[model samples]
Target: MDYERARAEQKLQLQELENIRLEAYKNSRLYKEKVTAVHDKNIKRREFQPGDLIFLYNSRMRLMPGKLRSRWDGLYRIERVEPYGVFHLSHPSSSELIKVNGIRLKLFHSEKMARNQELEIFLLEDPTTADD
Candidate 1:
């Protein structure tokens, strides 16, 4: 009788351990699924096309000496779209096209274009006319 009781207790303990392990596995799978769903939703799949003008972040663009330091430069024209969102850009200063990642580029809006145009016009205007 004593031996039978000991064996029964051992079986119950083993069953409990198995249950705990299964629960842990289920929880881990649930967490992974939730994380994957959120990541998929946040991914930007839209690709930039040829002829689209974008602003290259200063940190990403190669700097040249004696040039005005700008946080955002190059109304870069997209020459080609490569795999994995990489782009071929025609940088005005470089005059040579270069490949860059899409994350480093931001699409330019019409409002920004208007503002830059106004600034260019003001800079080019005669100073004598302003005093008149």
Candidate 2:
């Protein structure tokens, strides 16, 4: 009779452990869903239209030597914008075109500024010191 009571208590403990494990799984799922929602809210949507000037990001920059090497290539004209973040690009000087993911590109907003335009420099005057 003692053996039977001990077996019953063991079974109850096993049942409680299983319930705790299931509750932990449920809590983990809820945490992941909340985290995903927060992450999606901060993501910026990239939009590009055809004929827009944009720079292509070089993915192979780590293999090159320079520490300050620029990762972005010269502005390439968008030939076509496809569904699912695919962009057709072409260099202004070349007729050849290449298709690349939209994530690897950024818009160049230099249309308002002329290529040969010069910037005006302003000089700051030093404060006058009174000599004794």
Candidate 3:
């Protein structure tokens, strides 16, 4: 019967469409994993300890009109480091302490540089000519 043949064709078409959908889903999952891997690879890990100095990133400035101003604000000391990248910071000039996410802060490299007492500079000299 023509009706039976048409029904068989429709079932085949449905199966084909499902196969395409499944392939697309697999591809999407693969793409997401690749993207996540790339993103995780580029992430920089930051660690802080008690008494360590750090600078806090000011994310609020992006909405404001200050383009030339520096976005980092601090010289805060890490009073404590909590689990999951949370830090307690205290400003040098203030007694109040605040809890902030570690991602918003970066170690103050000045502490390391200041410890080095020696400064080195290299100067390049030109060869003198015999006809001088």
Candidate 4:
């Protein structure tokens, strides 16, 4: 009788352990689903239109003029739109224009252009010529 009781206890313990492991896996799957939902909600999609100026990311070939610099270069007009948000930009500096994706471009706003205009005025203004 003692041996039978010991065997029964061992079986119960194994079942308990399996239940605990299944619970842990269920919790982990739930956590992963929640995290993925939050991440998807927070992701933003970018779109561009014609005449919009964009700053191209420097990931092109080494021979490209903007490849050496990482920061924003002068404005380039959007000449054509391609699949998956890719665009073709035209600038006077280059004959072949560049093709870049939406992820590699940042939208330029008029507010930034106004700020640049103000900075240029400040640099070009002569302090002596101004009436104080």
Candidate 5:
């Protein structure tokens, strides 16, 4: 019967549509994972040593009314560098030590700049051309 044939065709079409949808979902998940891997690869690795000075990021600074205010606070010295992004910091004025995430801190390079200022500069003179 023609009705039976048409019903079989309709069932086949529905099955094909479901297969296509599943394939699409698989592709989307793969793409998302690839993007995440690339992002993690691009992140810079931070290393800290004991006695190094660093600035801590103040998460609450954004809530303040002043737009010009710096989000980074503290010139704390690194007392210890623990595994897995944990840093122990101590302030010169404070006796207590604080443990913070390494992601929230950046090394203060002011000491490097001071050492760079002592470098001697040489002025080079070009040889005079006789054709002039």
Candidate 6:
């Protein structure tokens, strides 16, 4: 009977559609794996050591109204460096130690300046000294 033949053909088509759906799912997983590999390869490792001077990001600073205010609020010293980018920081004036991620810290660089001077800048309106 033609009806029997049509039913058999429909069953074969349904089986083929199921196989196609499984193959699509497999390809999606493969694509995600490749993307993850590429992302992991491009990440730069951060390293820190004890006694290093660094600034820490203050997450709460963004809540303030000052648009130009600095969000980084640390002159913290690295007291200890732990596994997986964790750092223990100590402020010179504070006895308490805080643990933070290395991603929240950046190395602090500075040059020694004269004691009575205002941080390496000359007042344009001020009278010049005899040494000038």
Best by lDDT: 5
- Tens digits of per-residue lDDT for model 4, 1-132: 999999999999999999999999999999999999999999986788988887776554455554334456657889899887878999868878688777878887877777775553323333485566
Ten consecutive residues with minimal summed lDDT in candidate 4? 118-127
Error of 1 at 2 (Å): 3.2
lDDT of 6 by residue, 31-99 (tens): 999999999999987677798788999999878877666778779999988888889999999999999
lDDT of all the models against the reference? 0.81, 0.89, 0.88, 0.79, 0.90, 0.86
lDDT of 1 by residue, 1-132 (tens): 999999999999999999999999999999999999999999977567899889888773355543444567768999998888789999767778888888888887756777775553323332487558
Predicted structure 5: lDDT? 0.90
lDDT of 5 by residue, 32-112 (tens): 999999999998877989998999999998788665567888799999888898999999999999999999999899777
RMSD of each: 7.4, 8.4, 9.4, 7.9, 11.2, 7.6
Q: What's the ranking of the predictions by lDDT, best on top?
A: 5, 2, 3, 6, 1, 4
Q: After superposition, how far is residue 64 of candidate 5 from its true place, in Å?
A: 1.6
Q: Which candidate has the top score in TM-score?
A: 2
Count backbone overlaps in model 2: 0
Give lDDT: candidate 6, residue 86. 87
Off by over 4 Å in 5: 116-132
TM-score ranking, best first: 2, 3, 5, 6, 1, 4
Worst 10 residues of 3 by lDDT: 119-128
Candidate 3 overall Cα lDDT vs. reference? 0.88
User: Where does the lowest 10-residue lDDT sum fall in candidate 6?
Assistant: 110-119
Candidate 2 regions with alpha-carbon error over 4 angstroms: 111-132
Count steric clashes of candidate 1: 0
Error of 6 at 92 (Å): 1.1
Candidate 3 residue runs with Cα over 4 Å from true position: 115-132
